[model samples]
Target chain A: MKRNKAVIAGIGQTEFSKNSGRSELQLSCEAIKLALDDAGLAPSDVDGFSTFTIDNNEDVDIIRSMGIETLRFSSRTPHGGGGSMATIAHGMAAVESGLCNTFVCLRAMNERSEARFGIAHMAPNSNNKGSGSGFLEWSMPFGAATPAAWTGIQAQRYMARYGLTNADFAPISVLQRKNAATNPLAWYYQKPITIEDHQSSRWIVEPVFRLLDCCQESDGGVALVITTEERARDLRQKPALIAHATQSIPFDTETVTNFYHKDLTVFDSGVQCAKEL
Target chain B: MTTNVKATIPANVPATMPRPQPLPGRDSAFFWDGAARGELMGQRCAACKLFRHPPRPMCPNCQSVEREEVRLSGRGTIHAFIHPVHPMIPMFDYPLTCVLVDLEEGIRIFSNLYECEKEDVRIGMPVEVFFVPTAGDKQVPVFRPARDAKAGSKGARS
Candidate 1:
């Protein structure tokens, strides 16, 4: 439907930390303030909200603090990690559909302090509202509890099919650490790891992942403001045009415990989603 | 206000330890029931003979709702497997080997693999299922290296 008609007018992020100490709502307000300032707009200009459902912060709560006059639309991407791009997709769709003039997409969390993904959640015992109630019900009883254990299934298959060794994944960690080390806002800023360090680090799951391969679980907020491309051009800075946005769920796809697929090695769904983007 | 319902717990589970029980009330009660009996079961499309694991109500192929139960051969190659070094959950031992066995029936199953060192495990390595009986007559499928994996080795496949 002639998509890409919307463009992101601003982006805002808070310093990443293992513990922000502040409440998630406070973090959400701070990021939203920065986003509005970056876009050369006030909170009053924000007419819609899009965010991570997994985020502890709520849009209405954030809006209450910002004193946003009205919200014409709001949404959250339901599935956790896989929904990042989809969050942007829904934001752009809001702009395209004329549902709202300014749509803000946000993801904020104190993952380590507030709710640790791998460490804290010992599910079925925790709650059933989480998507884990699906396939995880089968695996968790057997100790396949964390995301790494789940992804290890696919990662192992990928390494096997390609003859890739654990060392092969080290370069990726090294490169990311190098990049993060330079970004002052990153939790690992100015701290880089070597392949040696990555290799020696304890394994979270074997055959593919080590401690370094995993991302930092931190407390932070990141937000983007999207508006129609025509309106975006009049803003304070160059707009990041929504050239493309797409989400794909292929056959035999389960959110994370997607063990049943015939070809677990390749992210066929991700490849297709990227193609659409 | 404590009460008792021990039938939900597998027999072999230690009383002090909390075990992961499948969240029931789905279309696949038979699959778990079969696991309790040490058998592997899958759903077969009555129309196309296509097999599905963790049974579902509808057939993905041919859009047929009609289905029947079939017991699988429980033999497959190691499509991929992992050994978690840290063992996040207490139910498993550290250096745990979890496998995604690509069943000969063209379906896949997730389970633990045993009877081998971490280095000895390989993709495409042959394996067969065995049952680990748990509390209340429930059992979980686990794989071990196939005896005929090599020609004279017993793990051989055509």
Candidate 2:
């Protein structure tokens, strides 16, 4: 489908943190309200919503509390951080397909205070049965049980093949931190680290990564308002045009386990998405 | 011979009897076999003459099923590393290091470094393979310093 027709009219976010000090519904409303304000619109103008499946906030709850009228569309995307851009893509699709004229895509979570997703292992539970807990069952018994540990396999393989060092990965953290420092809304606002600091930081999964290299588990909500290019031009904020959007999955792919791929360093799905876009 | 003994052990401890699991699929069977033998194995494509890891059947370069299982030298230089402050699952309370190693055979392997201090690990340190066994008699290959290499040495630091 041709998808270059929609644009983001406004963007809003709540403070990122270990705790949000509010319910998921409240955080969602706050972000939606800010986004509507940024677009110079009211709650009554928003007719659609899109977010992540991991998100606890409900669209019905948001609509009821925010007094939003004429709810036409609402959906959710999966796949953790990979869903960030996918959420925007969904909003664009909704606008282009005439499912909703004015849509808001949001990602809000109390990832830190309530449930720290970074935790490596959860006790064997009913939800973890069958294929869901397969990888866990394989690695947990050997102490390679955390996300860092799982990802460390890829990192180690990449290093072994590329002659890369911890210093090479410093750039990723450095870039993110650099962007976060200037971002007033970021939890680590104005907090920048030096290469020396990264080197000196404590290790999390030896030889593969350190503490400073990881992204923070933030408790924040970010929302974006999308509309047709025509309406976007009439909106108050400068529209961030949606140039292109697509999602991809590679062959023999599993959630977080693509070990069979020839090159662990390069994510084929990401490469495919970039190429398709 | 060993299979017969293993088959009989289950009857003595029915509750603790381990199920006979199938071997990993074609793509990962080599890796699992290498781990069993305490060897780090990677795939080298005959078509393109390039080495790859997390072993797969077809060559990623040429999509050729004609490949060979080659044992890596197990010697590599640390390419990249990370220290995660917030503990990731399974391994908690201990500082973890994620090391990227450039294998001599032109493939990269990702694994943990053990039997060394976290502060002592440097970005470019030369390391060799070590194996840690897992359940079902599987061995997980890891790496560590090859010699008395200090963390701040010229070759060790980024």
Candidate 3:
């Protein structure tokens, strides 16, 4: 594949916290402003916008509040967390295709303070359409209401097929905390954990995941500025050139709750994305 | 190891707060209807003869809009199971176990497992489907250890 001349000019984020004490839109605006300032550009310079479909902050609201002079491109990627990085791909595509000269990509979530993903109950069928509803109709009636429950069932098959034990998962959590301990922006800054900590943590889903194995519910926002490599080189920051950016959703994969797929042990989408990259 | 944990909705939850019911849509009405009628249902691609669960309008294999409603054996092997321990919903009892059963028809279903000990649940264990009442007077499919399966036989670790 031919490489694009697009580059990431700047990145900015709000402080990671349990309660941001701000609306999701406000958090988004703050992060966008910070990202613009870091890139030595004004809101008016941004011609394209991209974000995850699940983001509560609307592009129109952001544009009206930020006083953007013109807009040429905008897109919303689906699949929640799986689409997080796809926002950058959308930006890169816009800039490289000359649809827009500069792009702003963002994700602002008040996940913890507002609706907690871990415990929030979604009514089955939820108006009887879209990706997860059909799967939920099958699973939720059986008491697997949460993402943990659904994912744990899939994870168990992989573990059992491979003859692995829960102890094998401890190192991942331990290493993640160890990295977070040194990063000032990390919520777990200076709080490194051990494999023992992971082992002793209470089970969220027995024999599949411990509490430590899961992500913390957080409230915050992050934004990135993308532009052509030539334009980025003229800006204040060093340009990080893009090599390859892509997203994939292979056949038989749902956004989540993928028990219907032929092989539970394999992540076909992730494999497809890796092969593409 | 069979503790015989009663396979029913948690007793403490008030009758007014029932479990969410399956709202069947055009593509999936037959499957839920089959559950209510105590029959396991799936769809087979009319062109390719491939079986699909949680029925959809078209088959991925042949892109065929034509499909045949098929009755499943309701007999399957437990391909995976989990016991969720935290963030408990009121409508369900604690120590609840959910399983992904690979049915004899080659399709998979997500359903609850009962009439077996939590410790005894294992991947590849043979199970047979049974209907259970959920909210809204609707019946959903669940599974129990197959009656003819020998006791004390461990599932393959590999």
RMSD of candidates 1 onward, in order: 4.6, 9.1, 3.5
* Interface RMSD to the true structure, each candidate: 2.1, 6.8, 1.6
Q: How accurate locally is residue A104 in candidate 3, as Cα lDDT from 0 to 100?
A: 94
Off by over 4 Å in 2: A1-4, A126-137, B1-158
lDDT tens digits by residue: candidate 1, B42-132: 8899999899876788899888989988888888988778876654554454446788877888888888776777778877788988776
Lowest-scoring 10 consecutive residues by lDDT in candidate 2 chain A?
Answer: A124-133
Tens digit per residue, CA lDDT, model 3, A1-277 = 4434988898889988899998999899899999989988999999999988667788889999899887899998877588888888899889998899889999999988996778836565453433344566777676776677878877898898898878898898888888878968767789998888889989888889998988887899999999998888679899888887899987777766778777889988789889989
Worst 10 residues of 1 chain B by lDDT: B1-10
Candidate 2's TM-score:
0.66
- Model 1 residue runs over 4 Å out of place are A1-4, A125-127, B1-18, B135-137, B147-158
Lowest lDDT 10-residue stretch of candidate 1 chain A: A124-133
lDDT over C-alpha atoms for residue A134 of model 2: 43
Per-candidate Cα lDDT values, in order, are 0.76, 0.69, 0.80
Assign candidate 1 its CAPRI class: medium
Looking at candidate 3, what is the lDDT of residue B120?
85
Q: List, residue by residue over A1-277, the lDDT tens digit for candidate 2.
A: 5553898998888988778898777788889899999998889999988887667788888889999986888887765567666888888888988888899998877878875656754454412432342444334433354567667766766786788777888878887888889988888899988888888888776666888877788888889999988787778988888887888867644455444455678878889998988
